[model samples]
Target: MTYRGRFAPTPSGDLHRGSLLTAVASYLDARQADGAWHLRIDDIDPPREVPGAADRIQQQLAAHALHWDGSVQYQSQRHDAYAAAVDMLLASGHAFYCALSRRQLADLGGRHPGPAVAVSPASHSATNTNPNPNTDCAIRLAVPDTPICFTDRLQGRQCLSLGEADGAFVIRRRDKLYAYQLACALDDADQGMTHILRGADLMDSTLRQVHVLDCLGRTRPDYGHLPVLTDSDGNKLSKSAGAAALSPDTSANLYGALRLLALDPPADLAGAPCAEQLAWAIPQWQPARLNNTLTFGVADAP
Candidate 1:
């Protein structure tokens, strides 16, 4: 099968070192395999999205010569697709609407919802035939109790029971917005992503996505997670954590990013043109050599 990879970024913040590292790793992994690399801007959460962050992300990628295969994809415009997915899950009994609020769930010990909490559509229709406008209901996927397992190329074997890890997760919020897990899983499959290379922080999310794909009878993608970057304080280097945005000097920082991926660029390649640097690094790409740890500090940067 032809390998297809992607770098998806939320438009909440600018591309920082950590985000760039994942993008580079994904880009090289696809290019090394002679596969197509795609770019997706995850602009689903409009309230949290920055006004200019999406365009800035594309510019940054271009500045580093990370041009994508085709035009960019935005999640916001795919609402109809997500809605159809939700409808399919509901009709197939793979998902149900729950009237229980978070506080109520907490009061009930925060475990997976039983029949009482998982309101059946038939019961809902009978009880509120007209459907109260004030009623709050969120759509949640029904996950099996069995463990979901997948081996990561870098992180090795992994398994998790969705029941224990995250109960029946919401696919659509009460406020009428599709959840991240739902959108991500459907988008990856819809885009024909054969391989996924992202930060390790989303490993748990992989399980959820796998279950989603299984529920839809869609094939799951091969997943590989790269180590997450952290600051000196050991906190994740993320926009929410106030991590500094990457400088505009792409060539200067491209060398350091390569080193962070465990690629040893020749001394002469330092500050070289981005294309030249990438050409030298692609053939030498060895994902197994990447650090298996979940997190690495910026102090490790070259």
Candidate 2:
């Protein structure tokens, strides 16, 4: 338990500014803590993954000098592992198949995929409403009645009952794809990741992941959800918003990412070499100094 950490990025596009900021922060945090950091490419969904995007992502990480200690972990090669996880959950009785379609489930409970809106007194923790025999539904974890709570290194002392966050969402989709909740939880545990640093957009998802960990009899890890990278109009940084992709060839690109993470670069080395700048940044990095706001930028990452 030497402060293991990881940065798992989806290879749907080039490394936009937001992603760069996350990697730099995670890299510096691990280096500063004198811990090991691992990189895991979340390329489970092949259709959504862009061609050559994964290679480009690694190229960009190299450009940023955000080197990981061990061999990279790719989710694409882990389907058999995911299958084993799914089978294990099914056998343990902690997970079950649900035939409730989007429409039927939403009609009864506001929105099918939204945060737990109105807790059903009748259905809360009751196994009777488990998917009816006729309908085809996704597998959902049976979250306990107790609140799923954790202390975020940045946000701090958060709490939410299992039903409060998407009331029993799918771990295995109807399309047979692994839900991010189950996959990420299992991967984090398998890799011994004690510190998770990522975007604030995943804050809600963390609740479900925690429940999955509990169901698997695993302990939750420390977390730091950085603010969303947004556009000038205040939209979160994304391809839809047209954020600038990281320029691997551009000078001082990594420094800009560090600045976004709120790590103060030493003034003398403001224009110092990448290694030197990173050397200064790692020691100054602290998760508590970050903001939890849903960040957005107009054109580039801020």
Tens-place lDDT per residue, model 1, 1-302, is 99999999999889999999999999999999999999999988888898999999999999999989998999999999999999899899888777766655675567654333543333422132332324677778988878999999889999998887658888898889899999999999999999999999999999899999999999999999999998878888888777788988898778989998889898899879999999998899999887467877878976
lDDT, candidate 2, at 239: 53
- After superposition, which runs of candidate 1 have C-alpha atoms over 4 Å from their true positions? 114-116, 119-134
Please give, for residues 24-141, the per-residue lDDT of candidate 2 as tens digits.
Answer: 8888888888999899999877777889988988877876667887899998887887888878887997777765555557666632332233223335332344454234446777
> What global local distance difference test value does model 1 have?
0.86
Model 2: lowest-lDDT 10 consecutive positions = 111-120
Could you say which candidate leads in lDDT? Answer: 1
Task: Output the TM-score of candidate 1.
Answer: 0.93
Candidate 2 has what TM-score? 0.86
Error of 1 at 119 (Å): 7.1
